[model samples]
Target chain A: MKLVGIAGTIEDHSYNRTLLKFMANHFSDQVDIEVLDIQDVPLFNQSDDQTDGAPVQYLKRKIEGADGVILATPEHNHTTTAAMKSVLEWLSFKIHPLAGKPVMIVGASYFDQGSSRAQLNLRQILESPGVDANVFPGNEFLLGNVRDAFDDQNNLKDDKTISFLSSTLKKFLTFVTTINDMNAKVAAADWESEDLGAHGHVDTTIDGLDMHAADWVDQATKKTNAVSGDTYVRLDCGVLTVDQLNYFLNSMPMELTYVDANNQFLYYNHQTDPENMSAKRAPAQVGNPIEDCHPKRAIPHVKQAVHILRSGQTDLFKLPVPSDGSKADMHYYQAMHDKDGNYAGINEFVLDILPIVKYYLGLTGQKLVKDPNATDALTGASKKSDDAKPDDVSGASANTDEAPAEKPAEEPKPDVDSVSGASANN
Target chain B: MQKFIAMVGTNSTNSTNRKLLTYIQRHFADKAEIELMEIKDLPLFNKPEDRKVPAVVTEMANKIDAADGVIISTPEYDHSAPAALMNALEWLSFHITPFIDKPVMIVGASYGALGTSRAQEHLRQILDAPELRARIMPSSEYFLAHSLQAFDDDGNLVDEQNIKKLDGLFADFQIFVKISDQLKNAHGANYEEVRNLDWNK
Candidate 1:
């Protein structure tokens, strides 16, 4: 199968285009690779019909002939490049060449953030419109510090980057072949028609956005709840779920965070009352590099946590609860896992049990005596108190077998970046 | 008077690398002319009816061909060079093998600690391709780290220490370009031999 790679630049010395050139040359023997030039293609507008035109004709021919297409592009403001969108627009007008077509988007940027947001956004856009894209769960070719990677002669000089790219290309090649074979079968024997009944139409009631984020959060909450079931918390990809996330935030006294596999900020719990922190912060920080948040000294520990989490390991890191004259120490238990039981990333759940400590210290339950000031309501604990420390908590069970009222424990607010229930494809 | 050219290629609107290049361009303004080439203007590549090329393509090719030496300020993406930058380089090659035995210096910067190391390595491999005739700066010579904050508000390399590394890298690149010119004038016997070997093999 022939695989075609397209680069999204028109410079005389674009490093990304050169990488495509090298890949083309490397794979020239096994596959016929062609470099696409978008120079002649007019700005994509549906009104301008170019069915028989030169640029559109070329694009259609390429898509029709090739088994798969490789798109290498630059991230522009956390979204797909205008040039790339133009190509899609052109395609969408005629044949929708991207629909169900297996494509791989790989590119570079100087930002250590690794263009994950841009790539994720592009992948979503591509898949949003009936287009199927093969997005790797993690970054496929995230090359940081591009400035030093090439020589003056406009060639890539990095070895490990090349090695990994070649390996990744190998996987892409396999996927393309498999996809091509499937397409061929569907076309030749009407296989898809026969199996149409088995795979019915997908329900589109919920926008793909909410469907995925919701699914992710639901799974995450279920997993966390399953562990001891005493703690109630919520995790989000970013700070978007403020109202729902705040339920968790106000309920818990500890800070919580949800990050993607690459450690991009998904969501962060806001410090309650905001008396000490900035009120309005950059939402873009939701997808910023995790390392940017910590001091240089803490990088090693963060890296270790990431490694352990990525390798399907759950780690419990404990910090002595701060003994600020009035508070008891706290414990931090971080559970990291993918929704499908794979290693997606990490979640930091901060539990401050200082109030519990206070309760445990004063180990006596007091009953109110009959007095004019002792109202009936004053004899029992308030609903909020019951919810805060339910009957399940140690030494907190009320006497008699009567089921206690279900109190609302504050759920850990979604991290500042979480868009839980959003599709992982993004 | 010796001629020199500085080219900035990046996709970011507020590119720190571009700002760095702007600083370097000002430095060269005293001795040479510098131009900033924006990749955003170029259209996507299409192979159908590959006929007359676009004007920007021709303009870019001409710039690279006429330049005495090329200094590239690249931005890293996804652990590699941005495909936009890579596409620009490919388009340049298609017009005229401006990369063959040409004096080229690659430098990059980013907000990250290691700079564009991944992109640097990726570019190194591309330049080292069997068909491409080019010289590469050693890893130690390539300066790129914490460069976003390295520049002053005036768009000058404010960090004296980093400026020193850039100075060293550019100085070596200058020498490489001069030597390359001499070889080009001398019929580039070594480059021809390499090309011939590649063709015959």
Candidate 2:
């Protein structure tokens, strides 16, 4: 059970590195762990190889000699520290010390989720071709609310959390033995294989240019020599000019969008400017891959919704876009099929149904009242998973700015010029 | 025309991410005024006991405070943002809150196919932190994969599609900047919260 530990941060004072030191001493009876420092590991650059550098050599020799390694990472910008990543880059480049080594991940953060994202990212990086290491699976050694996790003696204070950590490490010792004995090559996870970039080509895909290009409309038009202006175009139901088709689609009550079968955002109705529209759509956003039009956090949900519609699991998937106000927006994703019953694309339409409901009530001369048995979650607004809602992110400081408590000031503000002088007055 | 601060999020002497930012600046010359900033000089953030921010960081913060918007082009290292960029952010969010409520656009370039996908995602979370609170442009990303081959001899972007993507994103970013001004309801509360932050607690 010989192991080497490296904290993901090079900060002068880091809870993650301290957590590693605690684990090494506390679990000395069960396992032998040596803590390493990344204080002098410079930022990684391919042109500036630090393989022969003293700092890198120190860790490389130790990692190569160890049976397993434990990475206690700190979450920075939702991932492992750049210092830790730099160390990995040097080790993986021209020297594969981490290759085939057993690795376990643990992390601590100021808030909850204790570096969850960073640990996942580290696993991905460690399993990469360059730094191919076998990572222990399933156990999530998360130490959240880490500021108070330790006492003055530098030992973990929580009995439950400490017991959990002890058990997780015990499992890790077993994981190391099993992995080292079998040396099995596991298949990639289900989620890892799916590419959201939408790079795969179908028959209608335009290959010459990037699908995310800003001028895709003009370029695609030129490439295809598409008819425009008053040019006549034959439709399935009738014949009309290009201008007439545009006028017809734009005049629709709901904002329309077309996402092709290949997951490309091919078209959207832009009758009004972005500021006025219920859902903003820029002309330049017309030909982007679907993922580009949404924040990274929403990608998983986007893929799920598309899959349900694409796989013939459902003909229509409706979502209520949440809003605090009475703007009860509704979004519908209707599946469009080709003549032969093949899934072609989605015809998504967005509209505020509140007006329609109001109109109905007015016509009927009726009043509106809340139902006591109604579930709020079922009818909640702001449900568009693709939308970038700030609430979705963990805003840790949302409430901390309230009236300061009467406790003594932690760090005297003699640091620099006052940043929020006006805030004090308010 | 809008004014912007374009930050090269890496310290490497030879970085395609820097080249990407340069391309954005030159390509959008007619639409906006763009000034490129480097994070290389800022030291790695160690949370000095004095709580004093470095002079260079203060200079950068002042520039960011004055700009209408910011464009950050990052290079992915080991599936996350480079330490140099994160180090710079650590200082920016420490005491000076220039990023607070400022309009920001995230773009990236990579030597491989993923194009810094994870790093941009990670950066989004960091910018969303209470201390930073940057109003990142919604629903848009510009990932320049195979960046080494993405540019020409004059540093102009070689691929027309990537050029268009950057163009579209920049155009959207301008609109986003204007809209950010309307989201001032939380401005006061945001500053107050940041000022009272005690990370040690």
Candidate 3:
């Protein structure tokens, strides 16, 4: 499980921060806990919205990607510090990354009360309609007289305290799973709201053009004065000409397609004839809404897949194609996110993994057989398997995770790259 | 006339709470010499080891000390008073005792129908803390709900009932201020007690 630790204090030295650091190091094996710094976050003033600012956006993206969040707070007055409150205000205002996200509160204090009042105050604030964070119940880890709580290397000296913290974290993880599962089930029916008509306009949605037009790609390229051929385009890590970019993408083994955040089918690697491709996508289908590109029967499934991806429920949705008992084709719908982790769109790719499986089996001298424990594995299934890193979903989008923040990450422009993750293909 | 400092809670450029305070200052002009102060300019409190307050905070404390009472007009954000106001209060109580034994009236305005009701309660608890120990007027709450529509073209409160309630509260606060001053037997002891507390030490 991945979690992010937010040390509520922006101070140079704080016991609260120390507590979080100790938790991160001690429980390093149990979870991926990245300690986020809040010093750069400006105070929340509705008059001055720094919501789109780098510091706040960084925290948002980090929290969005995390399975759960741990907030280590210090007491100021009888409540959480103003810095912590300010951060919460920013998170809740305009952008709600904490909404429906599971959060755990831990605190430390110089007094005997050990930030008791502050934690309660934090709970109240988090439960407000705007924040709406699912705070864990009944586990208050308050480190009192925190001055003597730690040793030379900042490790907690008390074994009893350490063991309690361990148990609390384990319980909190279980709570996180339960809450996420509940949210998925409850929100599953709400996916019908996904507007596949491309009615909503993004910044890149070209104006005064029919999205359903077969000549959309040609018209859009001309209207935008888009570069082509030897025109050099600067990428995140390298500079490549438009022709070079095409050559690289077209050489990819898997048939790839790009549907933008607005649900507009924008591009496909037209490497071969439509009949010869693994996924039969034509060049004329470019710039159509995803609804226009798929059959009526597939609309509901498409909407659900895109909805889960867009909502950050999961990063990637994969399903097996029911082929004529020959081709073991798999369709992967990977949710793309900007550097700030906003859902950009879907990077749908189809590839027959049979060749790779056969090659692996031949090299390893192993035979393909069903396990005795397997009850329903004869036909192609979703396979909710991220146990082993499924790194074989190859494409230019694999590099999108590392997209530079200097430019708009979700922009349909060639330089933009975004986030992607995996979910079972319900 | 009793002098009272009206502290506007939020740092937002446009706030109905500030409008409410402005209306109160003018509406109760003859009743009390109300001076408006903003918590916006004060820096966020980080609990410095030296325990020295900023110059702006000291200035605020001086004004509060000079005033006979304080009337805080607050706005709710995430079901609590804005952090800017909380930050100012933190600095005030960190080293100085501006609010100790001082008469305080908590009033709030909100765009929503709740009128910052929960936040006013929260502020009451904060002021009642040992570090603050403010003498808040009891059995009194004047929250202007749907405050956006409560004001008129001239910025006067449009509702006659709200005006009547505010007038009665202002009178009560004046009386409460005089009564609070007479109840200062433990003020000196409380100051010493607060000063000697094992804080940040």
lDDT of 1 by residue, A1-426 (tens): 766677765445455676677778766766677878766666543334665688767876787667788777765434445466556656764456665567877776665644555565556556644245444334367655566766666556887777887788778877877876575444423311221111212221112222123243344445444332334344555433435546766565656666555455456576644343222223334434555554555454345434433432224433333334355433333546545445444566555466775554344333224456544232222232233122122112121111223343443333333443544453
Best by TM-score: 3
Please provide, for model 3 over B124-198, each residue's C-alpha lDDT reduced to its tens digit, 9 standing for 90 to 100. 888988889999999999999999899988999999999999999999999999999899999999999998987
True contacts kept of 1: 0.03
Model 1 misplacement above 4 A: A1-426, B48-52, B130-132, B138-140, B185-201
True-vs-predicted CA distance for residue B87, candidate 3, Å: 0.5
Summarize candidate 1's per-residue lDDT along B1-201 as a digit string, tens digits.
Answer: 345445565655667777777877776666556666666555454322343456787787677667777677776654555545655554454323556665667778888787876666656655554334555544543556787678777778777777787766766766776776667663467456544642112
TM-score-based ranking: 3, 2, 1
Predicted candidate 3 versus true structure: per-residue lDDT over A3-98, tens digit per residue:
999988778898888999999999999987889999988878999999999999999999988889999989877888889999999999999989
Per-residue C-alpha lDDT of model 2 across residues A357-405, encoded as one tens digit per residue: 7876655455567668655453422233224232232110111112123
Q: 2 or 3, which is superior by DockQ? A: 3
lDDT tens digits, residues B1-201, model 2? 899999999888899988888888888899999999998877666668788999999999999999999999998766667767878888888877999999999999998999999889878977887788999998888899998898889999988888887778888899999999999998999999989877666
The full ranking of all candidates by DockQ, starting with the best, is: 3, 2, 1
Clash count, one per candidate: 96, 7, 6
> What is the CAPRI rating of model 2's predicted complex?
acceptable
How far is B20's C-alpha from truth in model 2 (Å)? Answer: 1.9
lDDT at A134 for candidate 2?
89
